[model samples]
Target: MYNVDDVVMYGTFGICKITAVEKRNFTGEEQEYFVLRHVNSDKNVFYVPTDNEAALSKLHSVCSKSDVDALISHMNSEKLIWIDNDAKRKEEYSRIIKEADYHEIIMLIKTLYLRRKELGAAGKKLRSSDENYLNLAENMLFEEFAYALDIERREVVDYIEKHIA
Candidate 1:
């Protein structure tokens, strides 16, 4: 259970704060909902039912700077299992996104980055869908990384590069 002011990563919403937790009878029965506000926005808000298991699955604790450091170092040897079959690739990537695992998200980014470079050298490009996935993964990662490290989102690439170097 999260309390007010606690920062958390909520699925595709990226970093958010638990602004409030109130019990209401909106559905004709009293239930609790977690009121969240996006860290980057003041107007955007979300209400997540506290008792909803499926929705709660997407809520995750924010990672720390050390966690980010270790992850980047580990990424040096990790590889993305490229699925040649389009359907399988899409399905697998979709599952990873739904699962909202930063480790897998980083792997996805690495895989696509390498694949894009390989294709670019061959005078080819990734399928548009793969490109979109890359963008999505990067956004998710950058948001969390920026929040965790107290850096700007644009600096995430340079940070990772410095670590990779």
Candidate 2:
């Protein structure tokens, strides 16, 4: 059971702080739920079902320096080939973001960066959906790394820029 003030990851909700854990009467039975406030949003709270599988299995931290290193390494790999179908590509990217893997997030960031550069070279720009996915993946990875390293998220970005650029 998580205590109040514990930082945890929630499915699709990203990182949150467990502000409260209280027992309440649910249909005449005692039940416990976590009151979680999103780390990145203002005044956003979630009542997380204590028994929800995804919530229970949520990652508390990246923990391993190797994970961050691996992510950086993967980001430097050859860019992915652009998918011809926009809808399919968006779906695949969404799935990759939701998986919340550090390496996958890095790959997404790398792919989108390359895509943006290529588009710029061709006198084009990224579509709104592509921009959203890139921001989401970058934010997710940054938050996880910052939490794990007990550093500011901006610091993570700076570190990545300095080391991985």
TM-scores, all candidates, are 0.95, 0.77
RMSD in order of candidates? 1.2, 3.2
Location of the lowest summed lDDT over 10 successive residues in candidate 1? 73-82
Off by over 4 Å in 2: 1-5, 24-31, 39-42, 54-66, 78-81
Instruction: Please name the candidate that would achieve the greatest lDDT relative to the true structure.
Output: 1
Model 2, residue 44: displacement in angstroms? Answer: 2.7
- lDDT tens per residue, model 1, 2-119: 7889999999888999999999787899999999999999898888899999988889889999999999998878878689999999999988888978788988999999999999
Model 1 misplaced regions, further than 4 Å: 25-28
User: lDDT tens digits, residues 2-120, model 2?
Assistant: 77888777755678888888777765877788888888785888776687667566545434556666666556674664567999989889888767766666777888888999999
Query: What TM-score would candidate 2 get against the native?
Result: 0.77
- In candidate 1, how many Å is residue 2 off? 1.4
Estimate every model's Cα lDDT from 0 to 1.
0.91, 0.75
lDDT of 1 at 112: 95
* Residue-pair clashes, model 2: 0
